[model samples]
Each structure stands twice: as C-alpha cells, then as structure tokens.
Target: MRTAYSVETVRAAERALMARLPEGALMQRAAAGLAAACADLLGRVYGSRVVLLVGSGDNGGDALYAGARLARRGAGVTAVLLAPGRAHASGLDALRRAGGRVTGADDAEGPIARADLVMDGIVGIGGKGGLRPDAERLAGLADRSRAAVVAVDLPSGVEADTGEVRGAAVRADLTVTFGTYKPGLLVDPAREYAGIVRLVDIGLELPGEAELEALQHADVAQLLPSPAAESDKYRRGVVGIAAGSARYPGAAVLAVSGALRGGAGAVRYVGPAGDAVIARFPETLVSDAGPAGAGRVQAWVVGPGAGDDAATVAEVLAADVPVLLDADGLRLAERDAVRGRTAPTLMTPHAGEAAALLGVRREEVEGARLAAARELAAAYRATVLLKGSTTLVADDGGGAVRVNATGTPWLATAGSGDVLSGLAGSLLAAGLAARDAGSAAAHLHGLAGRFAADGAPAGAHDVAALIPEAWRDVYH
Candidate 1:
C-alpha cells in the first residue's frame, strides 16, 4: 500500500528524527538526495546552469544546500532570494562558500529564464495558501521556460492535507518530497500539478496507518477472494440483485452483467424485469417474488433504476444480508432504516447524490472531494463510494480511505454505476469487508472499463463483456 501522512504527523516525525541526529543532519540527507536527483536530470552536473527560487523557510534551505553541492561540482548555480533576510542563514553561507552567486529576485529574472534547470523552493508543508506576489511571478516565469522544474517538497500552494489547490500553484516537472508522501501528491487537482513524484527517506519513522492510500496490484490481489479446492456452488456465496423497471430493464441487464462476471458462485436476481435479465444472461436465476424471497443470499444489491417502487425497496431491505445501495435506492432510503441495519451497508453515490446527502452544493463536493466522501460516510454510518474523475472510497470507522486512479473519462455513460454497484455487492457476498469490497470492486471495474474501450467509446455491454479479461489480468 502507498500511504500518505498528514502535515502535522510528518512534522512530528521530522522532529523526532531531528532530535536523535546532529543539527542539520536531516536537511543534509534531504539535500543530498535532491542533488543526486537533479544530477540525473541534467545528465552532467558540470557546465549546467541551475537556478533556485529561494523562499523564507526550511524548503529554501534544502534548495540552497543542494545548489552548493552542484556548484562545487562545476555547475553554474545561482540562488534568487525572494525574502533575503528571512532565508536560511546557514544554507546561504554554505552556498557562498561553495562559489554559488546569491542575488535578490529583482535582478534574477534573466538568469531564471535562461537556466537549464529550476528548483521551486517557494513553499513547503508550512505554507497556508497560494503563492505570494513575488513567488507567483517566479512561478509564471518558470511556466514559460523550457527548463525542467523540480519542486523541493510539494508543489507550492497545494493543500497538503486535503489535496485541494487554493489558488495558483507551481506545476513541477518533478516533485522530490522528503520522508513520506503527502495526501495532495496522490489525489487529483493538486496531483495533476505534480508531475512524477519521487520520495527520499530522510530517516523518519512513519505511522503504521495512513489517513489515505492508493492501492497497488499486490494489495488488490491479496484482498480478492479465490475459491477453495473443495468448494461447491452453494458453499462459495450467492449475490441477490434488485434492480430495473419496465421503462429501464437495461439497468437490470447491466446489474446482472456485473454480478455474473464478479467472483461469486451464483447470482439470484429479483425484480419486475426478470424476463429481460433472463434474455440477456440465461445463466442467472430470476424470480418475480422480489429480493426478500430470493432465498439464501450472502449479499444484496438494491437500487439502480429501481424507480419509485416503495414496496420493492422494502422487500430488498428486509433481507438479513450485506447490502449495497445506489441510484434511486439512494434517494428513497430512510436514514433511520440504513442506520439500524444489522449487516454492513455500502452506499455508492456520484457528486449529485452526495451533495443531497450532505446538504451542500455539488460544486462544494467537487472542490473538496476527500472531505465530502468522509463526511458522507460519517453521516450515514456506512462505507461511502464517491464516484467521479477520481473515485474515493471512505470507511465510517476512520480507517484509511482509498482513491482509484485507473478510470478513464469515457466511463461517464449510462448504466456504468449500476455495474459498479453489482460488482461491489458480489464482493461483499464473497466475504470481503465492506470497505475492501467497495474499493476492490472499483479497481476491477475501472480496469475492465478501460480494457473494453482501450482507444474508443464503448457502451455498457462492452464494459460488462471485458470483466473476465480484467479478472484474469489481476490473477496473472
């Protein structure tokens, strides 16, 4: 798992490590790693023109020290001090001793424009908002240059904890972060600004659990279920899906499409559109008696074009099994009933539904997606999947939240969410925890969606047809 730490936690860890080592040791380690990375980018340190945008904090210190190292190795290094008096005194002295020229920002624009490489040291974890006037001007200059840019810690002006960009931020070609990854480096909006991320371990022991994480292939493989040697169809698990109306029988087909492809032993579908589901997937066991009478299912998937049929909704909720709610089910769900469930519940909502649940505007949810997902989970006391450009899955128990980065923008089509809901429900039936099931299903769904439509636009059926290939790739 790739873990991300909050700014306060990173600071504490840095302090603990700093106390154990000699003064300036941590900064030296960071600077050395940074200098080595820059050397690789420049190909040869000698004769390369390097410019540092120095600010007023430890971030500038890291850049200055690294500049001194390059200067000693025959590179033409210059530091443009935005706040000369408040700059790291020791770093400035070291750079001067190593033959690096230091100048104020007023006279540094020409060198900055002509440099081969630029280091953005304008802000770090301690920064509150976007760039100051002087820093903004320098960032604009760097934007127009052909030189490769390296950010010292994080790209300046990004919210370290939430991954939200308050205002204009430096768009780095590469970000060399110290210790651990920040939340902003992994999420969108801010993540788009940070090009390729490289981590340098400066001897800070990180916490065991991170606030957020991006799942790797190994992590997903481990979480997914495989059938035992002696397992029978009845022994594995059964998933029941309640979906579709006469007007939207395709929703039922898509839901069953996901359920059959998901790693479940059998699928029992119950709804008014049973004949439509049977026509599409003849393997499914369909019943017109509704979800409650579907008989012995380990999990239930409700909603997805279920319309306003309160009677059917009640029947689906009556099942004593893990349940996943999506689409119209999300609209008709009573908070008290959802909260009173004995089994685990998962809710998958896009920005519009999440906005309704949180009583906030849709723009607010999109602006700060992480906060919106967490708040929705807490409000409904269920695992919440906030679907969009960057899919976020948040658990109500305050555990690690997951961000799915495998999806494409082409997934914004009809019945796509229904497929996701059924996939998650099937995983739940297979006995994975609610949070793991939701995230794992999303990962597979995204991969399948991409595979079905590699370079072209595909409808819902194409995505469903590619599920088997996705599962094979995961195992292989």
Candidate 2:
C-alpha cells in the first residue's frame, strides 16, 4: 500500500524528527535528494543551465541548497527569489559560495527560458487556494519554457490535503516529494497538475493511519478469494445481481459478465432482462421472483440500468447482507433506507450521480473529489466509491481514504461502470469489507480495462472478459 499524510500529521512528524537530528541535517538530506533528481533529469550537471524559483519558505531553502550542489558540480545555476529579503540566509550564502548567481523574479524569464531545468519551490504543502499573482506569472513562464519543470514537495497552488486546485497552479513535468506522498499527489484535479511523482525518504516516522492509501498489485493479491479443498459453489459465495430492465437489457448482461469473472462461485441474477442475461451467460442462476426470492446470496448488487424500480431497490436494501448500489439504484434508493441499514452498503457514483446525491453541481464534486467522497459517505452512513480519473473509496467511519488510478480513459465507454458494479459486488459476496471490496475491484477493473483496450477503444464486455487476465496478473 502507498500511503499519504495530511500537512498537519506530516508537520508533527517532521518536528519530532528534526528535534532528534542535528541542526540543518534534515534540510541537507532533502537538498541532496532534490539535487540528485535534478542531475538525473539533466543527464549531465556540468554546463547545464538551471533556474530555481525560490520563495521565503523552507521549500526555497531546499531549492537554494540544491542549486548550490548543482553549482559545485559545474552547472550554471541561478536562484530567482520571489521574496529576496526573506530567503533562507545560510542557503543563499551556500549558493553564492558555490558560484551560483542570484536574480529577482522580474529578471527570471530569460534564464528560465534558456534553462535545462526549472525547479519550483514557490509554495509548500501548507500553502493553499492557488498562487499569488507574481507567483502565477512565474508558474506560467515555467509552463511555456523548454525547461523540464520539477516541483519540490508538490506542485504549487494545489491543496495537499484535499486534492483541490482552486486557481492557477504549477504544472510540473515531475514532482520530488519528501518523506511520503501527499493526498494531492495521488488524487485527481491536483493529480493532473503533478505529472509524475518521486518520493524521497527524509526519515519522518508517520502514524499508523494515513490520510489516504493506494493499493498496489501485491496488496490487492492478498485480498483476493481462493477456494479451499472443501469449497463448493455455495461455499465459495454467490452474488445476487438485481439489474436491467425492458429498455436496457445489456446492463444485466454486462453486470452478470463481470460477476462471473469476479471470483464468485456463482451468480444469481433477478430482473426483466433474464432472457438477455441467460443468452449471454447461461451459467447464471436466473430468478424472476426479484431480490426476495433470488435464493440465498452472500451479497446483492442492485441497480445498473434498473430504470425506475424503487421497489426492487428498497427490497434489496432491506436484505440482511452486504449491498452495492450503482447506476439507477443510486438514484432510486431512499437515502434513509440506505442510512438505516445494519449491513454494509457500498455506494459507487461517478461525479454526476455524486453531485445529484449531494445536491451540488457536477463540477463541484469533480473539483473536490476527496471532500465529496467523504461527505457522501458520512451523509449516507455507507462506504462511497467515487469513480473518476482517480477512484476513491471512503468508509463512513473514516480513517484513510483509498485512492486508485489503475484505469484508462478507455474505461469511459458505455456499460463500463455497470461492469465495475458487478465486480465490486462479487467481492462483497466473497466477504471483503466494503472499503476493501471497492478498492480491490477498482484496481482489477482498471487493469482489465487496460488489458482490453491495449491502447485502443474496447467495449464493456471486453473489459469484463479481461478480469480473469487482470486477476491472474495480480495473483502471480
């Protein structure tokens, strides 16, 4: 698992570590890492033109010290001070001693344009709500420059805790973050601004609970269900899918297709699209008696293309088993019913559906995804899996929100979300907790999408068919 800490938690950890270390030792460690990364990017430090955008904060000190390192290695380094008077005194002296020159922000453009690399140390994790006008101009200049822009810690003007970019932010080709990841580096909106991220361990010990956690392949492999010798179809767990309608039968087929490959021993589907589902997947245990008579299932997946069947949604919600609500079920299910359920409920919504539930605009939800997912989870007393470029799974109790970015733009094709819904639901049936189920399913779904697409467009069924491929990749 890749973990991220909030600014507050990180600061506390940093302060504790700094107290135990010698004066200036931590900063030197950071600077050494930053300088090394810059050297790697430049391929050769000698004769390279490097521009550092320095502010008054410690980030500026990191940049200055790093520039000094480059300067000593025969690079032509220039520090452009946005706040000259407040720049780190010792760092400034070090840079000058190493033969690096100093320049004001106004004189930075020409050097920045000619540079091989531009280091952005304008703002650190504590800075929020975007860049100031002067800083924005410098960020713009860096964007236009031929130099490969590298941001220190994080890209300037993005919210480190919430992953929100309210105004003008630096767009870096790479970001060198220290100690651990920040939520902004992992979540989207701000994640889009941070092109690529590299973590440098400054040796700050964090608490057990992180602000956000991203599951890698090995982590996911542990969560997958494997049958024992005594296991049968019933013993392995059955997933009940109540989806589709007369108008949209494909949703049922797609959802059932995903469930079949989702490690469930069997899938019991109940809906108007029984014929369509049976034709596509004859292995499915079809039922016409709705969720109540879908036989016994370990979990239920309600609503992908279910249309206006509030009755079915309510019936499924009343069941004493884990439930995954998606598509039309997200729309039709009563809020109070979902909130009052004793069993675990996983609500998967894209931005638009999430916005509808929150009574906000779609853009609002998209812009502040971390906040929106937590809010929705709290509101419904259920786990929320907000689907987008970065899929986040936040539990109602709230510890660390899980973030997954294994998907491609190709996963946006029709019925893709329906496939994801079934996959996640199957995991729920296999007894993973709501958060685990959502996170692991998203990881697999995304990998399957990538395998299916392989750099071209693919349909939802193609994605579903590739789940076994994704599962095998993770398991091995």
Candidate 3:
C-alpha cells in the first residue's frame, strides 16, 4: 500500500528524525532529491534556466537550497523571494555562495516567464488557507509560463490534511514530497493539481498505521483472491446477491454480471428478477426465495433497484455475512439497523444518496468528496464508498481511507453501480476486509468500464461483460 499520513504526523516524524541528525541535514537531503529530480526533468543540468518561488518557511528553504545545488551544477538559477526578510538565512547564504541570484517579487514575473522550470515553495505543512496575494500573482504568472513546475512537499494552497483546495493552488507538473505521502497528494482536488507525485525518503520512521493510502499494483495483487489447487467451490467462498425487481430486471442482470466474473466459487441470486439474472449469467445459481432462504453465503449484496421493499432489505441485512449496501438499499436502510450489524457492512452511495444519508445538500457531498466519505463511514459505522469522478473509500474505524484514481467518467452509465456492488460483495466473500474489498472492486470496476468503452460511450452491460478481461489484466 502507498501510505499517506496527515501533515501533523509528517511534521512530528520529521522532528524526531531531525533531532537525531545534524542541523539542516533534513533540508539538504530534501534539496538534493529535489535538484536531482529537476535535473532529470531538464534532461541536462548544465545551462538550464531554473526559477524558485521562495516563500517564508521551510518550504522556501528547500527551494533555495535546491537552487544552490543547481547553480553549482552549471545551471542558471534565480530565487524569487516572496518574503525577503523571513527567508531561510542558511539556505539563502548557500545559494549566494553557489552563484545563484536572488530577485524580489517585483522582478519575478519576467524571470518566471522565461525560465525553463519553476520550483513552487510557496507553502508547506505550516500553511493554512490559500495563497497570499503576491504568491497568487506569481502562481498565475507561472501558469502562463512555458516552464515546467515542480512543487516541494505539496502544491501550495491545498489543505495538507483534507486534500481540499481552500483557494488558489499552484498546478505543478510534478510534486516531490519529503518523508512520506501527504493526504493532499493522494486525494482529489489537490491530487488534480499535482500532476505526478514522487516521494523522497528523508529517513524518518513513521509510527503506527497510516490515516490514508493509495493502492499500487503490488498491493492490489496481494489483496486479490487466487484459488488454490486443493480448494473446492465451497472453500473459495460464495456470494449472494439480493437485487432487482420485476420493474428493473436489468439491475439484477448487471449485479449478477459482476458477481459471476468475480473470483468467487459461486454466485447465488435471490430476488424477483432471478429469471432475468439467470438468462444473462447461466453460471449463477438462481433462487426464487428471498435473501433469508438463499442458503449459505459468505457475503451479501443488497439494494440495486429492489425498490422500496423494506422487508427484503432487512432480510439481507440480518444475514450473518459481510454485506455491501447500495442504490435503493441506501435509501430504504434503517441507519441504526446497519450500525447494529454483527458483520462488516460496506455502503456505496452516490452523491445524491450520500447527501440524503447525511441530511445535507447533494452539492455539499460533491464539493468535498473526501469529507463526505469519511463522514458517512463515521456516521454509519461502516466502510463507505462515495462514487464519483474520484471514488473514495473510507473505513469506519478511522483507519486508512482510499481514493481510487483508475476510473473513467464513462462509468456514469445506468446500472453501473449495481455491478460494482456485486463485485465488491464478491470480494468481501473472498475474505478481503471491507475497505480493501470496496477499493479493489472500485478499481476493477473502473478498469472494466474503461476497457469496455475504450474511449467511446458504452452501456452498463458492456461494462459488466468486460469484467473478466479486467480481472485477467489485474492478475497478469
């Protein structure tokens, strides 16, 4: 897993590491890594024009020191000091000694425009709200500049803890974060500003568990289910899906579509639309009885166009298995009943449903998706997946929340969410934790959506049919 700690955690870790090392050692390490990355971007260190947008804190110190390193390597470096008196004394001295020129904010615009690269050091962990007036102007100039921008720590003006951009934030072509990943670097809004992220280890030992994480290929591969030679159908785990109705048989088909392709031994369908589900997926075991009489299952997928049948939803929820709730299930759910469940519960809600659950406006949920997901997880005491452009999954226990970056906007098609619900439920049956199952399923669903569409518009069934290809790609 690619772990992301809050800014406070990073600062505390940095302090502990700093106490052990010599003064300015951490800054030098950060600068060295920054300079090296810039050199790589420039293709050659010699004669490269580099501009540093220096702020008042350690972030500016990192840029100034990096500027000194670049100057010594035969690059033309200029530091645009936003706060001249408050600049890091040692870092500025180092830059001057290395033949780097320092220019005031008044002289920055022209230099920034002509530079080959710009280093953004306007804010760091200490930063609160958006850019100050002068910094915003400089950032606007950088935006118009032909230069490639590299942000130190994180793109300035983004909330380091929440990934929310309070005001104007620098859009960096690349961000080189020190020690570990920050929440802003992994979550959206801020993630959108940070084009690509690179982590530079400063030898800080992180403590305990992370608050957030981004899943990598290896991490997902490890979490994925792989059948063993000795395993039987029962040993591989079974998933039961309670979805669709006479009015919406497509929901059942779509849900079974995902469950059938998932790495489960068998998929049991129990709903009014069993015939339709079986027609689409002959591999599924269709049952006319409700979820209560569906026999044994490791996990249950509830909702997905079951309409307003409170009794059906309650039966599924009462099952002694990990449950994934979605669609109309989210609407008809008794909040306390879900919270009282013995088994792990995962709630997948779109912005509208999430808004209803939280008693807030849909716009609020959309505006700050990370906050919404976390709030839902805390409120429902369940793993919550807020589906959107940047899908967020949060564990109820305040552990690592994940934001899936693999999906395409084309996934907005009808009944797509039903497929995701079934897929996640299947993974839950396969013995993955709720958070892992939800995130992994979201990732797979997204890849399948993209693969099915392939840059064109695709129907929900197309996305469902592409699950096997997506599963193969993940394993391969």
Q: RMSD, each candidate, Å?
A: 2.0, 0.8, 1.9
Stretches of candidate 2 off by over 4 Å are: none
- Model 3: lDDT equals 0.89
Off by over 4 Å in 3: none
User: Tens-digit lDDT track for model 2 on 278-374?
Assistant: 9989999999998898799999999999999999999999999999999999999999999999999999999999999999999999999999999
Once model 1 is optimally superposed onto the true structure by TM-score, how far is the C-alpha of residue 424 displaced, in angstroms? 1.1
lDDT (0 to 1) per candidate: 0.88, 0.95, 0.89
Write one digit per residue (lDDT tens) for candidate 1, span 1-476. Answer: 77889999999899999999999999999999999989999999999999999999999999999999999999999999999999999999999999999999888789888899999988988787788888888998988898899999899988888888888889999999999889888777788888888999888998668978888777888988889999877677899999999888889899989988778888999988999899988989898777666788999898988899767766667667889999999888888778777788899999999999889999888778899999998888889999987788998888778988777777888999989988888898889888989888888889888998898898878888887787777778
> What TM-score number comes out for model 3?
0.95
Candidate with best TM-score: 2
Candidate 3 per-residue lDDT over residues 1-476, each given as its tens digit: 78888777888998998999999999999999999988989998899899999999999999999999999999999999999999999999999999999999999977998899999998886676789899999999998999999999999988888888878889999999998888878877778888899889889899988878778666777888999999888788899999898888889888888887778899999988987877778889888877877789999999998988889889888877899999999998899999999899999999999999999999878767788898999999999998987789998888778878778889999989998998898999889889999988988899899998899999888988898888777767
The clash tally of candidate 1 reads: 0
Clashing pairs in 1: none
Which numbered prediction scores highest in lDDT against the true structure?
A: 2
